[model samples]
Target: MAKIPGVRPPDLSELTRAQDRMTFLYLERCVIHRESNAITATDERGTIHIPAASLGALLLGPGTNVSHAAMTLLAESGSTAVWVGERGVRYYAHGRSLARSSRLLQAQAELVTNRSSRLRVAREMYAMRFPGEDTSGLTMQQLRGREGARVRRTYREQAALHGVAWDKRRYDPDDFSSGDPINQALSAATTSMYGVVHAVVVALGCSPGLGFVHTGHVRSFVFDVADLYKAEYAIPCAFEIAAAGYADVAAETRRAMRDRFRDGRILERCSRDIHHLLLPADEPEADDLGPDVVRLWDGGSRTVAGGTSWDGEVDW
Candidate 1:
C-alpha cells in the first residue's frame, strides 16, 4: 500500500507580508477546505479558490465551516482568522499570531507599564490624529476634549460633504437595524477597520491587551491602532455610503471599505504606523520583526541562546 504524504507548511519567510496582502476576505455559508496552499470555499453556486498567503484576515461569517487542513494553511501563512457574526456585524473571537519572537511585545510592555512613557505614547497617538498640532504638553483630559472636538468636526464635515442628514452617533449592537443609515454604516465600517487592524497587531507580535491610551480591554491596542485611520478612512467611507442610501447598508459598506482599503494601501500604512508607535524612531527597521528563534532570559535586557544545557555552568 502507498502511504499518503503530508502537506508541507510554507516557511515564515516564504509567506506574504501582512502589509502586502489583501485587506481581508469574508466567507459565509460555505464549506472551506484545503487545496494545496490555497483554500477553496464551496456552496451551491460553486467553489472559489483563495491563496492563503495573500489573505490578511479571513472573516468566517455565519454558516462557514472550515476544515482543520484549511485552518493549518491559514495559520502557517500568518493569515488571521476572525470568527464573526452574520454579515460580519459582530466579532466573536480570533486566531493566533504569526510572531515567533517577543521583541516587539517586550517593547510594548515596557512602554505601556511605565506611566510617563505610556503618556508619551498616548500623546504620540493623538498627535497622529491631529497631524500638525503639537500634543506634547496637553494633559489626558485636554487630549480627550480635543479629540472629541475633532471627531465632532469630522462628522459634521463628512455629513455636509455627502449631503446626508446630520445626527449624533448612535448604535445598538444588539439591533443593527435600530440605528439610522449613517450610524449603521459607521458601525459596519468601524468593525471592518478593527478586523484589519487586529490582524496587523497580532502579526507584529504586540500584545493587543497592552495599550497606551485604551487600557483594560483585551483589544485595547487594536482599538488604539484602528483609531489612527478612523477619520481618514472609515468615517468618510461610512458617510458616503449612507448618503447613497443603499438597501443593504452593511454589505455595501463592507464592499466600499474593502476597495477603499486596497486603493489607500491601508494595510501598508497600518503596519508602518504600528511600528512607529511601538518602536523608537532611532531603532533600525528589519524585514522580520520577530524571527523564529528562541532565547533564554539572562536578566537586565540580555538573553542567552536557547536549547543549551546550562545546568552544570550555573550554581544550583
Candidate 2:
C-alpha cells in the first residue's frame, strides 16, 4: 500500500469537529475501495474520490459494495459509514468511533442506570423541547402525554400551513409505497437527521442506546437527539416538500433536507445539544472520576480510584 503523494492523511482530531465539513453524503450503486491513500468509489456511472475525513456521514444505500480497506480508512478518518436503505430511509449499521476517551459514555451510563437520575435527565431533555415552559416535578408518563400533544399540534400546524391532507403517519416497512407522499417525506427527513446525530454521538464517545428521553431501540439516543430539531427542520421541510408535489418527491425532499441542514447548522446544533443533555450543572470534570469509579481497561488511560491516580492499570 504505497502512499498517494498528494493525499495527506487525515488528522483524527479534526474529525471530531463538526464545522467546515459536508454534513451528509448519499452514495449508492457503487463499489467503494481504498486506492493508495484515498477512498474511491466505482459504479456504472463512473468513479469518484470520497473525501472521507471531511464528511460527517456517508450513507451507503442499496446496490453498494464496500471493501474492508475502505471501512478501515473511514473509521480512522472519523467519518461514519452508515448502511442505509434507499434514499437513506432506514439505518442498519454504523462504523467505529474516532474517539480515544470513554468519559462521555461513562457519564451517560451513570445517569441512565440510576432511576432518579434517569428521570431527571429525561425531564431536562423534555424541558429543552419547550423552552421557558416549566416542567418541574413532572413524571415520565406526564412528560410523554405532554410531548404527544405537542407533536400532534405541530402536525396540525404544518398541515394547515401547507394545506396537505392531515392523516396519521402511515408507513409499512414491507411496502413503503403504501404510505402517502407526506409521510414518506417526513420519514426521509427525520432519518437524515438521525444519521447526523448518530455520527456526532459516536464521535463524542457516547452510547446511542443509553438514552433518557427515548428507550428500547438501538438508536434511541439518536432519536432523542434528533427530536430536538424536529420542529424546526423535519416537520417544516416535510410540509414544504409535500406541498410542492414534485415529480420526484423523495429526491426533492432529500435535497431540501440537506439545504435545511446547512441553513440551520443542524449538525453543529446536534453536537451542542448532546453535550448539554448528558453533561449537567454538576458534571464531573473531564479528569475526575470520583469514588466508586471502576476502571475497565488498561491503555494510555489515567484513572483515579482508592485515592490514587495510576497509569496503564485497570482497577476493578
Output the number of the TM-score-best candidate.
1
RMSD of each: 2.0, 5.4
- Taking the tens digit of each residue's C-alpha lDDT, what string does model 2 give over 197-225? 88878776789998888889898888887
In model 1, the clashing pairs are none
Highest lDDT against the true fold, candidate: 1
lDDT of 1 at 61: 96
lDDT of 1 by residue, 1-316 (tens): 8766778878776787878989988889999999999999999999999999888999999999999999999998888999998778899988878777676888899899999999999999999998788999999999999989999999999999999998799999999899999999999999999999999888877888998889899999999999889998899999999999899998999999999999999989988888787788998755553566788888877889998888888786
Each candidate structure's TM-score, on Cα atoms with residue i matched to residue i, is 0.96, 0.85
**CA lDDT of each candidate?**
0.90, 0.79
lDDT of 2: 0.79
Off by over 4 Å in 2: 1-9, 13-16, 35-38, 282-316
